[model samples]
Target: MVSSYPVQFDVDFPARPLDRLTTAFRIIVAIPIVFLLAALTNDTVQGDHHSTFTFASGAGLLFVPLLLMILFRQKYPRWWFDWNINLLRFSNRVTAY
Candidate 1:
């Protein structure tokens, strides 16, 4: 019989020896990416990235509109659900990296 699982995760280890110096400074080096992820996920208030960040409500990650649609309208838009799924996948990918 064939397996029927729907999702899977796999990670490959590095082939060469890791550098201790870089490893020690990994947190410092990862600042940019951490900030990027923060900007993508966090919904900031007044004066914070008022010009640069344009994502409203953190790129639909919270899905409050979708929740309202489901609660009041009794219907869920497929596109909104897909958007949430893709965002989650992207988040997972970044964390995995």
Candidate 2:
């Protein structure tokens, strides 16, 4: 006898073009701001160059992804779509427009 339980399933949805580009832009801009704030706070607490440099390095590392994302935003719309769709899982029933 089969149990009368709700089954779980995964949905395959395509990401929208604008959503992908916007997300990449937001991430590219936000990472540095976040890391900078954290580093500055740590530096204030510890009064040392170590945390400052650590944060700076992190910001530098983030720049590459930011630049790459900006450059490829148009070229890799589909890839961006996949990334964005995974990032923003809206309800399928929701209608916008």
Candidate 3:
């Protein structure tokens, strides 16, 4: 007699050979993308000679503006709300990559 498990998994091996060169250099190829992800998330990139650059610095999630609008206008703008929500979603998706 045999007992059955609740869950089962199976995977087939690939027929084609894997690219060893690309796999070996994967980390080096991904360096620019890593920097891009960091910049999109409001990270500062510092360079030599006391130089520093920031990308999308002004594109931070809406906060102060939303607060001021909520306080004065007593309502949140649909576009602003959408912008903030989509920004977060986009960041999450990009980071997942």
Candidate 4:
């Protein structure tokens, strides 16, 4: 007897070989995207020499805003909910990559 799983996975591979240039500069090419992805999580890139203003976002999730809206108004605004939902989705994509 055999047990069955709830889900199945599969992938289709291209017959041709992978491109060399993209493979070589993949990291460099992905740098911009990484930065943008990080923004959703409030990632700040620090450079040499300090300045008065900083753009660092709170770690991981943006909870403070959600908490504030809920506590003060007793409701989670649609925009806030949407932002969080989309952020979670983008985060998953980055991890899957």
| Candidate models: Cα lDDT each | 0.71, 0.50, 0.72, 0.70
TM-score for candidate 3, residues paired by index: 0.43
Candidate 4 lDDT over residue span 1-97, tens digit each: 4449877766788788999886778778777877887655654556767844446554345577678879999987898768778878877766665
- Worst lDDT 10-window in candidate 4: 51-60
Candidate 1 lDDT tens digits, 1-97: 4558887656788899999887889778777876777666756455655555435546656567668888998988888779779878877867865
Better of 1 and 2 by TM-score: 1
What would the per-residue lDDT of candidate 2 be over residues 31-97, giving only the tens digit for each residue?
Answer: 6656544443323234566653333443345556766877987465465557447433432222121
Error of 4 at 85 (Å): 2.1
Q: Compare the candidates by TM-score and give the number of the best one.
A: 4
Candidate 4 wrongly placed segments (more than 4 Å): 1-10, 42-55, 58-63
Ranking by lDDT: 3, 1, 4, 2
As a whole number from 0 to 100, the lDDT of residue 89 in candidate 2 is: 42
Overall local distance difference test of candidate 3: 0.72
Candidate 2 runs further than 4 Å off: 1-18, 43-97
Per-residue lDDT for 21 in model 4?
Answer: 86
Q: Cα RMSD for candidate 4?
A: 5.4
lDDT of 3 by residue, 1-97 (tens): 4449877656677898979896789778767877665655676679998899865544565557778899999988999778669778767755654
Rank the models by TM-score, top first. Answer: 4, 1, 3, 2
TM-score of 4: 0.55
TM-score of each: 0.48, 0.23, 0.43, 0.55
